[model samples]
Target: MSDALAYDVFAKTCPSRGTLEHVTGRWGGLILGALHEGTFRFNELRRRVDGVSEKMLSQTLHALERDGLVHRDAQPTNPPRVDYRLTPLGHEVAGQLLGLIRLVEGRMDRVLAAREAYDAEHEPVTGRTA
Candidate 1:
């Protein structure tokens, strides 16, 4: 493999950009975090992840699976059972993502305060002339 291929994410034309996008998208983080706990059915995942549409969930799952981060198991049963879980690679990344989540949660107060200060300074004064 070429040196450029070693870190393809930096390449504009590399496919890793799509993979990175999939892994870091809004629904992707939540889905990975949910699966970190254990395997869950489609409905269960949908419930675990709030405000995710059925189509979005399916698309995210498919993306994750294609990237080899998620495992989909189809059981041979009466109604056919399907479960989704993280692969070893998924677990590793999930742990990192969870840590990031915790960091944001812990610092939310500071973040909010900063946002408030910024807005206070930036908001246009109704009585002031530009």
Candidate 2:
């Protein structure tokens, strides 16, 4: 008889334990969602998203491309244009990703309210200033 294969996400030592964090990181999630509509030129993407530095964007793109989620195209043109798009696999992953986003958006108000209440209830009124 053949041995059964196994996998678990709970153990911190698991190789894939950090994968979810990587795929769902601040830049990764946003970049994937943005690329869903269509390919975007480097500068156009920079303008579309607020607060992402150019270097970070480049690095994020490189990571996604390495993971087979994003495709980078550099055209031989006068202006030297480069754009990014999602692979078919990326579409599947990104759709699941959007699900997480929708979940967050639906419950964000409650989450924020809870955080506010926690802060108000826990703040030291007359404790150490620093």
Candidate 3:
């Protein structure tokens, strides 16, 4: 057998957990999904993944880049230009995430109904709504 170490994401001590978190975290998934469309500048990516603060976006991008799921290209000009895109691995992962995203979006009606039913069943008699 090859000496390459295998990673199991479910293992408590495995490093894959951190990468998984970076890929699935609130901002990470959105960033990856946005980048899957095309390469984008920092500000453009920020706008694409709305509601993310500049600092948070920067941090998330750095984490994703470190995980080799993102490629950061810097160009030297009168003003520096930076673009972010997905690596091959990132593209594969992003495709999977997009599938999940689409599934959730397509089933929102059912999800909303389920939520309402759950709330109705669990709500207090006072009717203040939880």
Stretches off by above 4 angstroms in model 3 are: 1-5, 127-130
Error of 3 at 69 (Å): 0.6
lDDT (0-100) at residue 87 of candidate 2?
Answer: 95
TM-score of 2: 0.83
Residue pairs in collision within model 2: none
Candidate 2 overall lDDT versus native: 0.83
lDDT of 3 by residue, 17-116 (tens): 9999999998999999999999999999999998999999999999999999999999997699999999999999999999999999999999999999
Residue 23, candidate 1: alpha-carbon lDDT = 81
Which digits, one per residue and each the tens of the lDDT, describe model 2 over residues 1-130? 1332343557777545555565788888888888887889988888776778999899888888888889999999998989899999889888999898889999999999999999999987886577
Segments in model 1 whose C-alpha atoms lie over 4 Å from true places: 2-5, 128-130
Clashes of each: 0, 0, 0
How do all models score by TM-score? Answer: 0.91, 0.83, 0.91
- The superposed Cα distance between candidate 2 and the true structure at residue 45, in angstroms, equals 1.4
Error of 2 at 46 (Å): 1.5
